[model samples]
Target chain A: MERPHNFSAGPCILPLEVFEKASQSVIDLDNSGLSILEISHRSTAFVGIIEKARELALQHLNLQDKGYKALFLQGGASMQFLMTAYNLLEKKAGYLDTGTWASNAIKEANNFGKTEVLASSKSSNYNYIPKDFLVPEGLDYLHYTSNNTIYGTQMKTFPKKENTPLVCDMSSDIFSRQLDYSQFDLIYAGAQKNMGPAGATLIVVKEDILGKVSRAIPSMMDYQLMIKKESMFNTPPVFSIYVSMLNLEWLSRNGGVPSIEKKNKAKADLIYSEIDRNPLFKGFTALEDRSMMNATFSLKDEQLGPKFDKLWKASHINGLNGHRSVGGYRASMYNALTLDSVKVLVDVMKNFEKTA
Target chain B: MERPHNFSAGPCILPLEVFEKASQSVIDLDNSGLSILEISHRSTAFVGIIEKARELALQHLNLQDKGYKALFLQGGASMQFLMTAYNLLEKKAGYLDTGTWASNAIKEANNFGKTEVLASSKSSNYNYIPKDFLVPEGLDYLHYTSNNTIYGTQMKTFPKKENTPLVCDMSSDIFSRQLDYSQFDLIYAGAQKNMGPAGATLIVVKEDILGKVSRAIPSMMDYQLMIKKESMFNTPPVFSIYVSMLNLEWLSRNGGVPSIEKKNKAKADLIYSEIDRNPLFKGFTALEDRSMMNATFSLKDEQLGPKFDKLWKASHINGLNGHRSVGGYRASMYNALTLDSVKVLVDVMKNFEKTA
Candidate 1:
């Protein structure tokens, strides 16, 4: 049976091949006569699996041997919002509030110390990425969200500054496109999008930026300790990391980030072009700032939502509904989603347009 | 192919039927044409899965509709060490230091407020559970580990006290035994053992116990907010929770905790009986306090170690090596490990003794 067009904005789509291998491994891992779920996290096989995942994550981002370490942590990026501040925020930190997640990161940071919102797009409902932000000196770190999944906006250019450390919540758009990954001191992404599954959060941090905070960081939240323990700080999400390893292997075999980036661009272009050309719908975010991962759009006539919804449902589409915060349609095009799936969605949009 | 007798401590054995269903769901969930890994946590299907899992968890613990809320949070029990303190540690908290995890919990709680060690078994290398410890008045809560995985000791009786809240880390032997689970104000367990896999942590808390602490709790760590969000505080460990839901369904179908407890007792009895009867083997922990889940034992003659190892390996035993802290063999018979597996291990031990 053909797979449905999965556009759910994370806990989202991963490679189908990864799923097949994971399915087999759940019953019997590498023919070891034991299920992956039953294996100890400290087992040699699991250590190798997690190590390879860490390696592949850095390799995809072109951050190998760059004074950086990758960790597969739990609690999603939401936990990282607290941890980044827990380990870094001593006196104060700077935040670029692009969307809901960034605002949340700032909220968690307030529990530790001062959180300076250097720039925010909340006034405009986070419809576009805030730019031309002035950076101040003596800040512990400058934080930003690389991609705003809820608002359908992504940072095209990162803040370039010296002395201050750069931190990013790349939950929605890491490994989707090639970038100067080493430029950021710390980067964290929830594995649900463009990686594998939901449980694991991929944190790639420059080692030098740690140990500067005065506060005592909990073992689970301490990145330096997690690195020292090799992401096995305490029972690192076994199955999540294993499947993530499989997905990263898939990404590596499919020409890594550069190759997948081209495909992602194509998918984004196809859907966005249709939304622009088709008068019945309008894109949500600014054209220049629209995310390549999640393309949020709205029907021109609110009364025609039922008609468009029916068209998409008939075409075997899934997760087309936008977040309630942003009332419209969101077509999340993660790496695993094929371009043919996007075409099916565009066709549904065209059919809806012609019919309504 | 015959499956190995898996004796992994935690992230240990789960029902094979759960594995089969999880395997199929990974490819396609209930004919939904979508991989379980790809479904959004907010999706209707996933919401149902989480809700059912939560209900089952409470039902198995016999804590349903008794002012208890079950949350499938991420970061394992390690995160809960900090969270329990972050949310509840006020003025002073008492801890019963049974083993490594208990020590770690006390350490994390120290960062928050005054943590009084009520009693400890560290003097004897945690070989026995400390008994008849006096419960202090005005304590915020009394904390203890229900089962010590590394040391192979289980709490047969809990502190009988009123007024002071009771919190227990039931990570290893949660569903393996029937208990007055409502007596404890809060209970947390890592899903790796007796539930599902590593990643999701089950937290069962009474509603009235929250919002008592003065310190500001982070969103991810705050149980009240998590309960309010119905465990969807953030994108949860989706696949882990789904597998846990499946495992819980399996447990429910197999007659829940009472029925599993009898089987667990049988497995523990079989292994312990063999250890006592076989002259070459001696049990590790105190006989009275021996764990039902993990039966740690060592060879009487050191020279026969290789011979015993060879016998178990030949019999297809896996994860029999004990924890580094306790240098012996540990046979962890979780809820999924059949009595036949225990018999196989016992036979291997009998054969080893006869050969020696």
Candidate 2:
């Protein structure tokens, strides 16, 4: 198979070094004679792995004492959505709908209690993040997706009301850029995106916001149990945890989020410039709310569809197709995506524009 | 540092090749330019992986339309102990306490409904599997552990009863030998010992025994939800599932269990013979009920204990320490243990006997 830039939504691309080192651990971890998979989670070595992963996460996010406890949990961000509601919401909840994931959060939260859709841009086919969205006054909590990957809409700026705690699903944008996490009571992202791997979900929850729920949560859903155990309530995905550590280490060494944010700006700029300059191509999402992580667009000449798709595939480019939930093509420029790859896509788009 | 024979009860030894292959997937799954750790559970490739893993499990266990569904879950056997009760036992339950794990099953079962210790060998320190154990007339199910890795005891025979289900935690010795599995209503195992890794738990439950409970179980804890989703209700541990496939493949090529049973017997016979015949060492477990997996023993000369431990460590043998609850050395010869390793232990015992 030709080397293609993977734009598949998670479990997405990981650094080559993370894979190679993680592979070797399957045979023998740090030459300990036991496969990393064979070691006990209760063992000191794994305990260190979990702790280091947590420490790196804190350092990388620079939220060491922002009233948040970082937790690496099983299940995925979907589970965290339920857990967030299970732990926090008693009567009713508030959700800002920008895309599929935020709506998914709303659906799961509704299973537990009343979930009010505070605002939605669904009437615009989710092309924009509704700026005038109202987060209800008496909501148990307000939730939003930081970056909408499917529809390619992102909220460039957040409205801050210090009285209410914010919960954000930064699944697609985590580690891609720094955030004012202090404004959020809870943040969760599945690791497949910019973090490490798919099997673990990273949750940053403010401890003070807990202990208000009246329901008896089963042990698996209880954030308190996860916190008490320090996310070692059971055997965590060790390999995922370790690879995440490697990615975190990579992020920290490369001047952290500030440096990566610049690289992100450059890549997003190149691809968006291509989309704007081209006559045949048009970005589908509302321009002001365009995503930096995922750039989505389509051809104005619908008949050129087959030729354009075939061109990108022939050039060994992958994950360039948009989500089937909405039509057209999308390019996910995650953290692992390099500037050259974006240039390749830009060049491909330019040629397609000229030919059309 | 030293190559010690691992005696860790769960999160125990696994097939070396499984570890190697599993590790490779962690970094790069099927060379898809995607790490298995980062792959989507919904992707065609990962769906195949989960499906095939479940198929192999069903095929190997000869589950045979017994109305049993096989699922890969988390929280280990301990969670299953509670889940089994939550799903099936609306009334009273019965548990036979042979050792630590079986008692744990009883403990978790009590959290849901009434539980009777139908039989217990705790009085004898659980050295022997009690025979002619009474199966209570009216109970939800009779629970037993097939093998006691901690106490070095094996239940050679199970209670023969119809109309009632037999639930067993075959965690330590699930694939060690053949069994009339038709007799068991539900069987669950943590995969670290005879199966694969720690993060995943395998459960086989008959359909008839479920849907009886009144208490609301968290969706994560409900076995039925796992079965319904084919164990992908949430992000299943992809790396662990892949490793389990390798182990299952290894087991299949190994002429399945018929071949493994013979090898397990031979290894146990060689080591048990040395312990029974040797004068300086006495088998700590009852002779009639010694474990084929965990062989426990102590020296007649207690002062030479430090020397024996150091000697084994110097010889590059490891994981020989027994449980802190039961102090002594235990040689756990799971499926991956070569007969040659047991010979090494037998030879060491012989040399110590002559010197004493």
lDDT of 2 by residue, A143-227 (tens): 8899998898887777756567788898899888867767778889888788877667898888888888888765666777788
Please write out the lDDT profile of model 1 over residues B129-200, one tens digit for every residue: 999789888999999899999989999889856888899999999998988998999999999999999999
Question: Please, what is the TM-score per model?
Answer: 0.99, 0.89
Q: After superposition, how far is residue B74 of candidate 1 from its true place, in Å?
A: 0.7
Pairs that clash in candidate 2: A11-B38, B4-B317, B4-B318, B5-B318
lDDT of 1 by residue, A58-92 (tens): 99998999999999999889999998998899999
Assess each model's interface with DockQ, reporting 2 decimals per model.
Answer: 0.89, 0.43
